[model samples]
Target chain A: MASGDREESKCCFKEWMTTQEEDLSELFQALTVEPENIDQLKQLAEKSITHFQDYIKRRNKLAHKDISAYFAPNWCSPWENSLLWVAGCRPSLFFRLVYALSGSEVESNLTEFLLGTKEGYLGEVMSSTQLLMINALQSKTISEEERLTMKLAALQEDIADQPIAMIAKGLSKVGEMNGEVEKVLDNHGRQMVKVLEEADGLRMNTLKELVKILSPLQAVDFLVASKKLHLCVHNWGRQRDQKLGRKEIDEEC
Target chain B: MASGDREESKCCFKEWMTTQEEDLSELFQALTVEPENIDQLKQLAEKSITHFQDYIKRRNKLAHKDISAYFAPNWCSPWENSLLWVAGCRPSLFFRLVYALSGSEVESNLTEFLLGTKEGYLGEVMSSTQLLMINALQSKTISEEERLTMKLAALQEDIADQPIAMIAKGLSKVGEMNGEVEKVLDNHGRQMVKVLEEADGLRMNTLKELVKILSPLQAVDFLVASKKLHLCVHNWGRQRDQKLGRKEIDEEC
Candidate 1:
């Protein structure tokens, strides 16, 4: 890849992050607006989802040539990279967020009113049916993650037995690696890209499914929370990097 | 990390690779040299191991601040990153290399003479005892990989429930994330560094044990093969990257 192309990919991700900040601000506005502007909230929520889809599309294009870049993206902070799975956040995170948000709301209501209520106002944010569906989606997503992880393990193992082995044998005989070795490595790269694509597919599907399960207002709240967490983590990672005496990436770049 | 420091890490790794190339050349020279310099071969093999240990130590220090860089290291090619386990190649890969080299020797001997040979010259490169030991080591390494992978999975899942959830709650209440959120992320980063350290330990131990299991000449052969494979894959990855129109990091830089 050309250095220019690499910079382009980094810029692409940075732009996406900037868009995320904008989306979060808009989401917060929708959440706090008077008269419960349901149409505005719904439109903003859908727009957020569309924006995510577009970002994924752009990422997929870059990943086809350099998927490893995403897996260990230099654009993100070390702290953020440490938590990454398959190049981005885990899809099942949405379920955990729902449970956490609902649980927190319930706890706050109890503390405020001292009532033994089973549910809070926001508790109905997720219906029992929605919870069941989300739970099922979570199970499926987790299992998919496990499957991809094992596949990755196998791929890592193959590194020694396949290309490395062939190259070793060729070197021992001919004093150099042959062209076939390159082909083998390229094949391996293609498989890695496939695993990455599958992972991205799971992430996108999980988000869409979760959004589908929520009411427009609830979805806006969830979106607001999700974006807030993302932006917060990014900023926090930058702060931690600075404290650790690490040079942070230039946001403008 | 500062761009210069990042460049230093890359240079550190590149220097290591240059050493590997030199080592491979020496190993092959040792293999083909007359009078079979056992002392020289053993010294070279030991030096190779020591170099690896030193590299790991240096990497560990860097990882204390930016362990994620190792996991998704830019110093390596995308192909190399695709196969990385815990910031480097899998420890179990050594066992596979032993098996492949031994298996190929056996096959070539069988085909050369059309005789049902019980054991070829290189077939005994690993004795029954050594094979048993290596098998044990492989199992241990694989199980260790599994454990680390599971730990990573848990860590990824915790991202949403721990830091993200807390940040979300804090933002909803106070219109901003609190300092506590950064602490949570810092804690997660520490755990990640620990996991990377464990993986490096496993990799070093596996190499040491495998070397111990082989005769000096056999060890030289194995080392030669290993280094050749390493250099080949790295070069292959770079070529592939170039062919894919990706920007390659300048070698001098």
Candidate 2:
């Protein structure tokens, strides 16, 4: 979270939005392939929406599990803490994409759709760290230091392509110190070092992968389209419920 | 993070939605004071939306600062970690409220509003801890142990308003230990003890304060309305852009 890092992240985020727009436009074009295929397209879109909803719910589960691990002494890392805010954006982003493709159709059922889809996505981005943290907390035979040493080794394997040998070595030495740390306090206590030093690079890589997955569609232009679609459908559903004076619409949430 | 805590939090969220719905309805009734004041109402609403947008931006600054402190060891806490997810819902909640009041009007200026408002509110919830942690890290004279002891003392004062003496005492004792010995640690190593022990109680307190602030408004039922308005306005803007082939609409984000 250095000022330089912040500037880089902001630039990266803008670049991502630009890429998503292009990809979404392509997806929309592909979907419009045959106006005659509209029925099939709607069916497929509905299924995709449902999958997105499930994905959101799973992220909530993951957040809860990860937070559970955090209470255990050594389970949470500083990099993971920094990433939590960004990760929370996933659910809204997912909903935005789905709502965009679904068009401006707002109905009684849309309330159910919005209400049913709950949760966020911090869990997905930090999945590897969360799993390892949870396992370390649960393992009875291994000491916390041993667990950390293993975690560092595992990270080295995961980021083999990245140039993070220094980070790996720093963490490895810290793990080995095992709290008997009067010897090399200066070495271990550098100012706010991030354990996952390459997290931003990894996120940019993931964004690229996501764009690839979202490419090949028609030209709907998701950057603006999806957000507007979300607003329209949301308001439509609200007005419908208001027209009915149905208090129960919101009770389901 | 526990099943029971999740259930309780879910219920609390539902209650919040219901309360918001009631408040929105009241606000709408007040806005139609004479129907002749329609222009003035629109102006006031726009101002309110701008204020909400500023609030969201302030939260982003807070998050960046807090995340920076997260790199400093032991500065962040488990309770703070769990709260980060819930804190992030504030922006969407603010937008939903404004959009609910704004009706279905999707203007060109509104597109800018949608694109301009970006970021969430995780940092606000953990600001107190982040400040204390950063201060602890930077203080030249105070040992880490002394800083922790001071944190425990502050927590005792804060929770004195509640009835959590056991939690306060336990943490205070842990603070005093200063990493002394590592025996009999099983009692303190429950996977999600933080979730049930402090989270529910803390959230309930926060909810009570929020309700107090929101209680005076009249009831037009914003629970579903706000979310729907958000979606409707969002989609309306996007569709407008799509119609214009204005690819630059989303570039601002």
Candidate 3:
């Protein structure tokens, strides 16, 4: 019975793989010729970014799914993995192409477009940073609101003032975790705190440097777009967390 | 017997995982403290780049290994995949950190270090582009020298004049492959050709734009370093290809 169920899932996966391959082939066929002008290039960039965004959404969905889903531990097929690689590579190649063509004049537009992409590289950085912090704390879970607040505090200058205090609070919580963890922090946390403080500065400087390449309005657009994606991811995380909580309650009952 | 072999491989992989995790933990501890000055930051950047380069080398080594080796398709355990992701992410995060702190003065040094990192982003782009071309041709084998010549041609200006002609020859060969293939090409190949041609242009322009941010000497260093890594990957590919070829002959005999 279990083997039969696995076979069914494999068949479905194969069907999905066919559709994805067609999409990829179509993209490759479209790329046979390069765009001759800026307008054409921009269109290509937009298309690529859109496709890339779709893949990211799928990737994130897979990542956060329950253990019983298609990608449970030790169950990811090579075909599925290769598809993910292709999805990732396609958009990246397009992005590099766009970046290459974005001369000084269109640099700002390109920057805005890049940031506006669903959970773009900047957002990835923010999430990764938060993950690093969470790992250091040896925490079990981070709240959706916490993640959103942290991202907002980093991206939105008006609220950037809150991050330091937040960091302090987070550090104190880590200190409270246990004696052993606290001792680890005490031995190394001073430098870690300094790094965290400096990391915020670095983040801000990086954003400023990136935006300096853009016009003022473009810079504003970039930030606005980034904020939107951050909120989106945050909301998604919260929904997932709530669903998991409900499941746990039912299981316990 | 097969299950026993799998168990043996899993054990070896577990040993590798422990060592890698320790390295990662040490890196995190090192990064816990922020560098105090520009000089300190430079040292950090240098050390991080070296480590990143090492990861890239390992990644490349795994990629070119024969199918019978550590990573067989469909045999990738989640643990192995996660390790690959970590290897990729660690270098990228460090590269971004270095980029963030590299003010205009040190930008060149950072850029050179980045390009020198074994199969870094630029190398990734080049390799992807080659893969695209190879896939398009649907050919069984590509010579190592052919691949190396193509990369060197892209990276070196004195020889940059030759790649276009080489690309043209490659396209013509694709055209001659078969009537059905030619028909497919005739139907969709024009755009694909343009994309590849424009891709090369984009690549050159991208390099120029990135190098523009560096000092002239640094720019030269960047190119030189990039060229060196390209050759390294190319040579590795050749050696791997030879091994595979010899194995095939041995099997046939």
Best by lDDT: 1
What is the Å distance of residue B186 in model 3 from its true position? 28
User: With candidate 1 superimposed using the best TM-score fit, by how many Å does residue B123's alpha carbon deviate from the native?
Assistant: 3.9
Looking at candidate 1 chain B, the ten consecutive residues that score lowest on lDDT are: B116-125
Native-referenced Cα lDDT, model 2: 0.29
**Model 2: residue A11 alpha-carbon error in angstroms:** 0.9
lDDT of 2 by residue, B81-197 (tens): 222322322122222232323222233235546687411111212245443543333242123223432332233222212112112222322112222211111121121222222
CAPRI verdict on model 3?
Answer: incorrect
Report the number of clashing residue pairs per model: 6, 38, 11
What is the C-alpha DockQ of each candidate?
A: 0.36, 0.03, 0.02
The candidate with the higher DockQ, 1 or 2, is 1
Q: Give me the TM-scores of chain B across the candidates.
A: 0.88, 0.24, 0.29
lDDT of 3 by residue, B129-174 (tens): 4435434332211132234223322222111122221222223222
Alpha-carbon local distance difference test for all models = 0.73, 0.29, 0.30
Q: Considering the two chains of model 2, state its CAPRI-style docking category.
A: incorrect
- TM-score: which is higher, 1 or 3? 1
Among these predictions, the greatest DockQ belongs to 1
Report the lDDT tens digits of candidate 1 across residue range A114-213.
7654422345455788778878888998999889878877777787784467565566543343677656756776888888889888888888888787
